[model samples]
Target: MKKRLPLIFTSVLSLSVLLAGCGTTAKTGSTATPTTQATAAATTAATPAPKKDAEPFTVSLRHIQIGDAQKFRKAILDDVVKKTEGEIPGLKFELDGVEDQVNRFTKLPAEMAANNPPKIFDLFGGTGDALKFAKAGRLLDLTPIITELGIKDKFVNLSQFSLDGKVYGLPIGGSSEGFYYNVPMFEKYGIKPPTTWDELTAAAETLKKNGITPIAMGSKGAWVPNMLVNTLMGRYAGPDIVNQIPAGTKKWSDPEVVAALTTFQDWEKKGYFTKGELGLEYPDMLNQFVTGKAGMMFDGSWRSSVFKDPAQAKDLTNKVSYIALPGVANGKGDQTAINGNYSNGYGFSSSLKDNELKAVKAFIKNLYNEDMQVRGLLEDNLLPSMKLSDAAVGKVTDPIVKQVLESYKKAGSVFSHFDSTVPSDVYKETESQLQKLIAGKATPQEMADAIQKVQDAAIAKK
Candidate 1:
């Protein structure tokens, strides 16, 4: 997302006054009445005056292309804007329409550099593009403003938005990644959610023997397979080790990582994935799972909402259940250390006016207020980052939402999704390389070496 730069001259002028006052104050004698009064006056004058009943600036908004167009465009955005208006009095947001994911990724940074950038924009999860923008000084440091607004403590898992101890964004929602299985199919085949790696492989073999595709995967997007790979890494190497590789502490060629990749390749050979998955588009993979043509799918909690409506997922709704990705022996991570990442939130530009920053903060607070949080979960079927007072989830009729909420509450730790934590340029490389490893085009050692090369370059840049 692009941040709106604050009005720089005004802030600099105020800062200069404060600094000048500090430098000259001690030189003036306190015994002199004139000097004392002047010093006091200067100190008071140096303080930046707060806006008094100023008209709220209009914030032009753009969001990512939502999967559920009807709900997001028609319902969620309007509700948030309306609630914001109520909370911030005169604040207003003008929807500039949804930006396609590809366009948003490619065009938004340039747009932000232009004079007429949108006041707010939605950034995709896991691309690290937002962080890059922040590093370039395009994003506003919201930590101080967030603290002043008293919403800082409301954030759970602050680590999600923290890069080197500085917060560049707020996570508005979160979801977990795991295996989504067909309950009825499991019953019919006498299969159960796999509790161990061996059991998972056995189940996959059973499905293959019965001529049913064991896993429905969409490799066209490439990130889909990386999600599963991440899950496997978390289980086999544990969250700490897996996280270290990305952070430049651990080598990619660690034995645990090799074992996980080896297992992935073995599964591919055992016919665990959908035929022609490499050629299938993301939507087609989703369609296969929703239509019950596939026995299982590896996806996140967001998939629950996609499969909740019988009208949309006729064969999948009410039949789907999720479980933590199975574990291998010596897998030191707990089930709670599952694959997950924070939902996108707003980031401001450093050049925004104080009034504008205040307005943005107020708008955000209202958007995450108790009622909106409930509505986000219930009506829109989206998780809210705010901690809910009750798990009843009121209007969210989808059993899957309830299940997801339960799972989140019990989770021990959340790891950033594979693509989200990796640098934007290397994201596709990671995905493509992992695919090659799975296809037997590259050995696990070679895959590890390739990833190490990327990781080494990234760390050197840091």
Candidate 2:
């Protein structure tokens, strides 16, 4: 049988402390003698004219939807609305926003700054987060309400959503990134997975010695290379280090960061990756690894589904082993941490009127109920944020997803994926420079300096 996560705090809605539906009493008059004109005036005052001031109530629930997971979630939301419409009468949900991140975030912030905004929306969990809105007093304080609903105990990564001891949002899924290696190549070469930077380099050397490509990576989009660079940064300066760089407390050129970048440059020179990697695209990188041309690939854990896709080669499914990139030797950072995040969950707006608040609150309560939580795990292969029931755990059948979960267990903490914590302009500049850094056209210092300049400018604008 497959395994499931155990749930806690499941029955709060059924509690007797819940608010009762309020009732109103109609007015009655005492018997009295009245003139015809007085009685007519009294009757006219008691009657109401057409309700001229009433308006349609609407709440926009915005989210960036992409890929299979978002598709599944949208379907779930549709079902939820179907089941909930009658329970929250007169409430209108407008699902709004572009599916891509660029449009999603840009539009969201502008709306937030203006008079109109999505009343509740799914949010990213890192630096470019709902917390910024929360800090600006634009988001609702969900702390007391979440506590009442016992939602705080439902998620494992609430720390990511929390600010100044209060949570601003809840996550739909937990995100993790790590290495997925070809087990066949490792065993054939008598090479074990590395646990430190030196050991990892040694393993790469061994693979090169045997005419095997060490790491399968594509840098065409730039984001690909940052994964390795970010992981190296975590190992060198610890998880919180890069976070400071964006806030102007630290520079990208700090020696430790330089060292991390230098190491990244060194890896390229060592020929651990494919030739002209900056020209390679993502699919080619996956193809290289899955087809056994390379010994390992670095990517998102969500790729597990693709690895197991029936359309892909049979070799990938049976031969891959997911593992964390080894830590830096004698580094100041937490050796066991991973580059990860939680994303896609509701964030309430401060602008909601009383009726809107009540309706949205009820929706949030239903959103994380056991049924939806289980469906996310079983149908989506998501690292669910909600606590699960034993029955739900038993429904998870993917071994690779299970492995990814166990690997995350080794992390003492999770750092943001580099892009999530940096300004889009800064992130773009840094990612673009990574291609140059990888191709030996740019030195680590140059890359770091360029990144710092962009970040500094973005911060100044803020």
Q: Measured by C-alpha RMSD in angstroms, how accurate is candidate 2?
A: 13.8
Measured with C-alpha atoms, the lDDT of residue 350 in candidate 1 is: 57
lDDT of 2: 0.74
The sequence of per-residue lDDT tens digits that candidate 1 reaches over residues 205-241 is 7777888888998786677787788888887777776
Question: What TM-score does candidate 2 get on C-alpha atoms?
Answer: 0.72
In order of appearance, the predictions have TM-scores of 0.77, 0.72
Q: How far is 336's C-alpha from truth in model 2 (Å)?
A: 2.4
Compute the lDDT of residue 278 as modeled in candidate 1: 81
Off by over 4 Å in 1: 1-58, 69-74, 83-105, 109-117, 124-127, 163-166, 333-336, 353-359, 391-398, 406-412, 438-440
Query: Largest lDDT belongs to which candidate?
Result: 2
Tell me the number of clashing residue pairs for each predicted model: 9, 2
lDDT of 2 by residue, 296-413 (tens): 8888775666655545645666567777877776666688888776755777887878879877778777776778877766555567787776777778777777877777777897
